[model samples]
Target: MSAIEALYIFDEHNATILEHVYRGRPPTASVLLPLYLSHPSPQPSLIYLPNTHPPTLVYSIIQDRLLFLSPSSAESEPLLALEFLHRVADALEDFLGSPLLASKIESSYDVVAQLLSEMCDGGLVSNTEPNALRDVVEAPNWVKGLLGGVGLPSSSPSLNPSSQTPFSLPRPSLPRAPSAATANPVPWRRANVRHTSNELYVDIVETLSITLAPSGRPLSALAFGTVAFTAKVSGVPDLILQLNAPGGILNTISLPVFHPCVRLGRWKEKPGELSFVPPDGRFVLAGYEADLLGDDHLASFTSTSSTSKSLASLNLPATPAVSVSLGPTGADFEVRLSISPRFQNKPSASTASSSSRGGLGSRSASAFSATGTTAHPHIEEVKVHIPLPAAVRTIADLRTSRGDAQYAPGDTGIEWRVAAKDVAALLASHHGGSVSASATLRGSVVGEEEEDEETAPSVSLEAGSRWEYDEDEGGGYQTSSSVEPAQQRNGNGKGEAEAEQRSKRRVALNRVLMPSSATVSFSVKGWLASGIKVDALMVDAKRSKGLGAGVTPYKGVKYLTVSRKGVEARC
Candidate 1:
């Protein structure tokens, strides 16, 4: 089996910024760049290069207009190589900060080399965990200047070298201490970690991707969920995370994958229970995929006794729904989006009076979080994405009851944004007691015949001897009596041609203007879709073998719900 031979970073113009060789002899950038670019625009993430002197596999990913490419000559696991490239990109971003620009890479070569060394060992994959990398990597002094430029705290602990890869910078002479790997055996976490203010945060983010039919029936629905943990606790701690869903856990979650630190035996005992000693700082604890269309919805589509299909449509979860229709003129379109907050709450007696006056009429905009707690989670970054057809020339009569919207001539579609406070208020005012923020996008398509016909009706003919009109048998005014039969036939033919053109234009506009689907993105802190809760984070005295006796750490937990490019609806 082949392994990653070399890694290359390029700018937007295909200029090589950095190249690191890992295993075998790899082709140079001059040979691979043109080969990869030859595939045409919007290239695939993975490609094969058989025409090269030696057949090579290329795995690439684009971030912030910077391209990360990895090439291998021997037969290698495609996914393994691709995953390594992704890890490199993520590690780079964590070290150099977001929007990994050409300038950042240029100035941070020392840090980049050190990180690549730690993440890969001679082309074989090594430690890529951000938290683990932090323990070994030293922070570059340039980061201090960069952080200052960004108006961040110079002493922020998160910015310390422990959060990501080690910077390849000179360090002062000091006595060496036992490393995390030698002392703890677990390579993901640092040893003897300590924090003044012990705190833990569990952020659950779910992205929704769904398609709905014209009749409001779901075609496919999926939710990708991730549990992100930021630990600031002291010493080694053992914790159990419990989660519950509307239905049984087995029926809801599928294809669940967890961090290496999690104890598989505990999860096997109780599916949603996570037991593990978390790494220092922040990391993804687990991830899972949820079939929003549950068993009940699936059962409704099949028949047990008869070989007949059920006349039922899958009702999607309370998500943003979009519908597109032709305007009265049939040469334009109207896109309407219906938004419903996934979080619902029951107002308590103490806050009922204030809640009612708070503009949350019947729906609860901010409610108790996903852990079945009283903490209210605020809705933020509510946006609806509607993809339009290429034929749309311009938009007109664009209106929204809440928020703002805009689109260009060749834009895929319009994007509508609603303020967090307004989304909460709208949700409260709705009948369902959930956040309700919908938008209406109206637009006109290109219609040349319609424009000409509109002008033709307004033009008046001159009254002359050659244009003497005749009265029809039913008292209606007809064409001029002196007009020749051939001229009249030509006139009728022109009218037919205009009508046919208008009908064809309308049909084209209708076909191209109808929106197929729309996606919703938003975030809610202190909330989770799976109703998961952190009951307690305990430092097992027997299992935990760090710190002195009589040590009590301040521990807290939080939950969050997010949908970024996950929720989609079609019509």
Candidate 2:
């Protein structure tokens, strides 16, 4: 803030006070403190500081760091006794980097100080006037301890705290988060599946099994429960399937068709025999044909590897999670399976570095993870946006109107940041692969009427995600089954629902984008159904899990999706 507009002695507490004129414009988040005390005494404050270029003030204690600011500045007006005391706290915080985030903040402060001192040859405040804020200063015993003997405090000999604890990883506490944003990095494990190629490649050694939601059924007027198949034994199954989508891979849901045969089973994974094999060392399903589905075939692959490792070795979700994945290999290829209907964590997940102003509350955070036979042969990414309901939004607005919730230059909506690598790694670790990519920049502030194009910038991994994949893709649609798979079969693509409630669960949509390879169907515990039909899709190798062909990535692009309400399709 520029300077206090006015200061006065408190008529009630006989203390000094300061008032600040912060934000006065719409589309801006502002903070107003009309009772800032200048006297070092505990009495109430009567000073004000108003509108200036998004002012930043570092709050510090006698010899300790306390808080930070975006554009920290020096005092432009006479320091009220209270204000002077606060300056100590602010300076200490500036020097020490209060509340301690990563060590980088202290370094940042040092850099900024060096520049200021070198450029302007300005004087750094040393001594302080008395009676300001009083013992409100950090305890002498905690001076050095507060900073764990690093940065500002460590450099200053006299100011260091006497009673300090040894340096160690501090337990996470709620107070450390920046006041302007939400902070909490959700814990997620890499989704280790059969497909390791986030690029492009398919398998033929294993029969391809396909499933859709709605299961030729219907959702209640209130929307049907999204059913998901969990896991399956990867081998030659009685039947194999592939999606025949033509609305362009980007527009897979626009078209829909019925699979020749496939039924649903709950936890019941029993088939007559090992139905098919990967003839070309590729992943395949029995009785399915490739040429009939058109050369639109994006990728073609075959598998020839054996499963010496089992799913039990990994400490992940439920066992056999679904109920598919049981088949005999023709040559050897990792099987690709997914859940039907799809199950998602309602709150989704959030990262530690997100804006806090307009974000959803803590109650709206969640995490989802799964593991399987292989680590990386394929990769998938899902994005779900849950906007605030009108009721909550209204309440938040009312609070803001009363000068509570914040937004704008300094303030913003609470944010949830998920690094691109996080999703990439989840796909990697499971397939026994590695994730590589170009770093991404943080999102920027927006205008209210901003179009999606301007608001959504393109993003991707610098290098492709890598895995030790030995699987291939399938061609055409279903090749093995003519009598259809089964009804209510156990979960394979879909894992077991929470033991408590297996019915009518409200969840988010799980969108799966294959690595540039359209042919490699990576096995997923819950991403699709068992009976989903497809009319036509322009499959490409770009989304493949292997470094095959046509491995493409798009920012904000609708890459892989399946909708069953009207038509069943996948991109």
Candidate 3:
């Protein structure tokens, strides 16, 4: 029995674009659209509609503003149907270019139909790889069109005109030979791939999400890492990569996921080793999550003793803190960013000398080492975002020690940006080198002004004496009493007590304007907070084919940590 019964595509306007039935009986698009839309949005990828004849399971995904729906009525692996839908979307985009548009699909219905039919045969997946499909399904060629329009054969004739007799019958058309990609056993990679320059690159990027309490203790910390590999070489090449961490590779990473090409058995035997035949171009090789606060670190944090010292041990490239000061006038806040000493130190002699020689000649030597053993890491793209309360009317008197701060009138937050050069300069200007540096950004908050309302004057008759009191424009009391003794009732104690109450009221007013949290966004190169590094990337010649003998591919790896307003400091 077929797993996928039918496929339906809808445009942004909720109108059907294309509908294809593979096998079995399924509900019509008219009936399915309403049932799918009936659910509240952010709808689940899988939905069950029991009202249908055999009951239907709808799997839907939205990409490039196009909706892809796959309905199945039979018992089958749910992942198979969902993965097929994703593959269909990817294949369409690969053929039609990025941002798959409705008009493109409508105009190229013939190509789409061929792709869908080839990718799924009788509701079972046949071929979904873009590289392999290119060999089977012919793409539209403008050159062939131009040749055919002018009454000429699309391809050049194999036989010469002199070799053919005048009365010779037209030669029978020959069957086209199968392409190498279609015949190759490997499904993901194309066959006979060749490149003028062979290079392999491994880029490890980790995004940080850290939450800190008002006392500066970390509540939670996590790093989501992805390993992206790029292989440009002739023929099929098998690659083996090794990764290492200070706290053992297995313990450092959790919930690891790998590409289909990677060998799971090898990874299972050796936790940090990956064996795979990579795709022709760039693709993600693996993904993993790491807890920055491990058991030991968490234990230290739980202890009341020296929480700051424990945080410093994390060796973060940059840390941000926000503090607000309340005064009689208004509220002022400051955002301070501290650059770690590891990033502040000067580059090694090798890097400094190579940089001084400045030219294309220094390119190779200046390249960062894959392990980051000799490279001097630097912080860049530093930005601090402070979200203010709605009561804050505007931010004024914005100032920064090393960068620029901006605030728009209607914006709900303030942004302070410090470029890499400024951060480097600040570190270099330190009186004594090898010390951490900091930058401060200060701004004043101006809240919405409140209007003062006037109240009726109070008249008090005490012991046969009539006293009338009114508040003057200066906010002081003016009293007119029929008896002179009543004037002496206002004494220094009452005046001082009233002054203290007014001071408390102003402090409360300023508290409303303070920002609740500040988030930091930055990108750090040649450094990873997780302390994971590439040990080696080796090409296995014995198991590989097509790669030339003694050809050493240029290999490089890069480490990057990015925080897109993910690090938050709460008030």
Best candidate (score: lDDT): 3
Clash-forming residue pairs, model 3: none
Candidate 1 per-residue lDDT, tens place, 1-571, comes to 5467899999999999998898767898878999999998898988989997688889998988988889888888988888888888888888788878888889989778878887888777887987666555654677657745654333334323333336656554432334435555666776556565666566566766666555555556677888887777667777666776656677788999999999999889988778898888788899888877665665644535321121122222235555454655455555555555444333444333332211112223243332222244445657777777665656666677777887776777788887656665766676774334455655556534445556775333533324334555645434445566787788788778977876776666566656677777776654565554544455566776564477665444445556675666666
RMSD of every candidate to native, in Å, equals: 8.8, 32.6, 6.9
Q: Residue by residue across 149-233, what tens digits does model 2's lDDT show?
A: 5322212222223443588655532212112232111111011122222211221121222222222111111111121111121
Ordered from best to worst lDDT, the candidate numbers read 3, 1, 2
Task: Kindly give the number of clashing pairs for every candidate.
Answer: 14, 195, 0
Please give the distance, in angstroms, between residue 194's alpha carbon in candidate 3 and its true position after superposition.
Answer: 2.8
TM-score of each: 0.75, 0.16, 0.77
User: What's the lDDT for all of these models?
Assistant: 0.66, 0.24, 0.77
Better of 2 and 3 by TM-score: 3
Error of 1 at 451 (Å): 3.4
- Residue 378, candidate 1: alpha-carbon lDDT: 44
- Of 1 and 3, the candidate ahead on lDDT is 3
Model 2: lDDT to the true structure: 0.24
